[model samples]
Structures are given as C-alpha cells and as structure tokens.
Target: MGKGTPAFGKHNNKLVHVVCRRCGKRSYHQRKKRCASCGFGRTASRRVYAWNKRT
Candidate 1:
C-alpha cells in the first residue's frame, strides 16, 4: 500500500446513507439530501412507476 491509499480510505469511509426525514429509512443519501426509497426532498408528489407493483 502507498501513502496515497490512506487518503482514498478516509474519503470512502464516510456515511453514505442516513435516516430520511419522511420515510424514516436509512436509504437517504447523506450528501445529496435525498431518499432513495421514498424519493423524499426531490419531489412533492409520490413516484409510482409501472415496474413497481402495488401492494
């Protein structure tokens, strides 16, 4: 390993997902401030795709 490898490790070690304010899931991106599961903070309407089946 080189000395530069530590820098990469430090940058990649940060949290990628945090708790979402709406969905309350840990699928929210910490840096982007958006939820992956519920699409919170991105849109006002709920997203429904044809690929996703309804329960």
Candidate 2:
C-alpha cells in the first residue's frame, strides 16, 4: 500500500505499459509522458488510431 503501488482488486492505478519507439523496448509511464528506458517523450511513442465502423 505504498505510494505509486497498484491497488488491490480492480482499483489499480498503475503506470501504463507502453513501447518506446526510439529504443523499441517496453516501458512504464505515467502522466509525465516520457519513456524511462530511453528518455523518449510521448512524441516518440506509437500512435493510436481509432476507427468507427458503421453498422
């Protein structure tokens, strides 16, 4: 129950897992929006695109 630790049973606020574009390695990041492994910021991360499908 320390600071930054994921909560138990569905209340977890852990750092999100993301892949670094520059280093191609997986890392954990929070609102700071930077890769801990390579020091790459959010701009160097992968882009996410959402598509809307019409029924």
Candidate 3:
C-alpha cells in the first residue's frame, strides 16, 4: 500500500539547493542555475517583491 514511501527515500542524495554566493543563503538551485534567495542567475536584482519586504 505504501508505494511512495520507499520510492522517495531512495533518491535522497540529490543536491538541489546550495549556499548562494550573493546573500550566502542555502537556496540556490543547482540545475536551474538560479538563486531562490537573491535571484543570482535569473535577474540582476534580488528576488523580492514590494509586499514581501524584509524589515
């Protein structure tokens, strides 16, 4: 019955996020080449919105 449980645990070594070079946060996607924290590869500016202001 639990077919998904065993399948998901087998591929746990996949490295998806890494330490971002700009913000130094662990949100950089390896395959996408884009930092989820600071928008390193996608855009020149940080990946943020006006409503989601940090302080």
Best by lDDT: 3
Error of 1 at 41 (Å): 1.1
Error of 1 at 51 (Å): 1.4
Top candidate on TM-score is 3
Better TM-score candidate (2, 3): 3
Every model's TM-score = 0.60, 0.42, 0.74
User: What overall lDDT goes with each candidate model?
Assistant: 0.77, 0.61, 0.88
Better of 1 and 2 by TM-score: 1
List model 2 lDDT by residue over 1-55, tens digit each. Answer: 6767574666645547577666777763656677766667755554433443344
Tens digit of per-residue lDDT, candidate 3, span 1-55:
5655656766858889999999899989999999998899999987888878877
Give lDDT: candidate 3, residue 51: 75
- TM accuracy, model 3: 0.74
Q: What's model 3's overall lDDT?
A: 0.88
Off by over 4 Å in 3: 1-5
